[model samples]
Target chain A: DTAVSQTPKYLVTQMGNDKSIKCEQNLGHDTMYWYKQDSKKFLKIMFSYNNKELIINETVPNRFSPKSPDKAHLNLHINSLELGDSAVYFCASSQGAGNNEKLFFGSGTQLSVL
Target chain B: AQKVTQAQTEISVVEKEDVTLDCVYETRDTTYYLFWYKQPPSGELVFLIRRNSFDEQNEISGRYSWNFQKSTSSFNFTITASQVVDSAVYFCAPSAAGNKLTFGGGTRVLVKP
Candidate 1:
């Protein structure tokens, strides 16, 4: 079974379009996170949710928001997509926050904002 | 605030060669965690290993080995007898207070057969 799964492995949209990427983990973990990998393959954390509560929010733009309705799911929604937002986004989950747990990551969603 | 840096951008080695990826990190927390992840062309990030801040011991698992030195704040990974299947981008990361991972600019390894 896939531990972490996400929808729309690839997304192609124009500027000003709003889109969402859904993520789910079956590992019954308590913490979920969103990370962005830019063209240079630089990975940065964007958000983190522990048991559906927001824990860490990085310096991402306001257009990007993450919602975790439950402990098993964390979704990212981007509004007014800009060219700079084009990158691969990965969803990950861990056992808990600051508990020295290894993360299980999804296959990632490659978003292209034209 | 924690940061991780992997100096080698990309490395290409022939099969059966030994390859190492270097990682340097900076953090104020006396107790923290360091991790290594492998991302293949398929785009999935696979967890490799994790080391604690206080443990400077070197570890070996199968064909993989990790040498962690706290004095230099470096956690290095070495692959013995590299194979084509070993081709992937390796990331070194440090954990913040909230378990937030700061990943280094990955080092892509391409082992040609």
Candidate 2:
């Protein structure tokens, strides 16, 4: 069984369109995170939620929004997608919101904006 | 700010050869955690190892080993007798006071037969 799973393994859309990528973890973790991997292979944290409460919000654009309905789910929605938004988005979770806890990552959603 | 740097963008090695991936991190916190992840072409990230700042011991797991040195702020991963399946993008991430992680520019390794 997959500990963390995200939908739409591959997403292709045109610029200016909107899209959402859903993620869920069966590990019963309290903290979830969304990370973006750029075309250059540089990974950056976008947002983090602990037990459905917003915790860490990075310098990401307002067009991107993260929604965590519960501790086990975190969904990312992008409005008016841009070409630069084409990247692999990963969802991760850990038992606690601490540096000491190792995160469990999901198979990334490869988003491609044309 | 927490930072993790993987200087080498990519490394190529022949089969059965040994390879080392270097990682450097910057954190002001006295205690921290360093992690390594491997993302194969399949797109799933596999957690490799986690090293706490207080523990300076080097760890070995079968063909994989990690060298963590706090003085130099470096955590390097060495692979013994690499195989084609070992080819993947390796990421070094370090977390400090915050719950989030600062990931390095991944180092892609290519193993040839």
Q: What DockQ does each listed candidate score?
A: 0.80, 0.78
Q: How would you encode candidate 2's per-residue C-alpha lDDT over A22-89 as one tens digit per residue?
A: 99999989999999988888889899998899899999999999998888899999999999999999
Judged by lDDT against the true structure, how good is candidate 1?
0.94
Candidate 2 TM-score to native: 0.96
**Model 1 chain A: worst 10 consecutive residues (lDDT sum):** A95-104
The global C-alpha lDDT for each of the candidates, from Candidate 1 onward, is: 0.94, 0.92
Q: What is the DockQ of candidate 1?
A: 0.80
**What's the distance in Å from true for residue A88, model 1?**
0.4
Q: Where in model 1 is the C-alpha error above 4 Å?
A: none
- Tens digit per residue, CA lDDT, model 2, B4-100: 8899999999999999999999988898889999989897888888899999999999999999999999999999999999999999999865467
Clashing pairs in 2: none
Q: Say which candidate scores most in TM-score.
A: 1
Q: Per-residue CA lDDT of candidate 1, range B3-90, in tens?
A: 8889999999999999999999999888889999999988899999899988788999999999999999999999999999999999
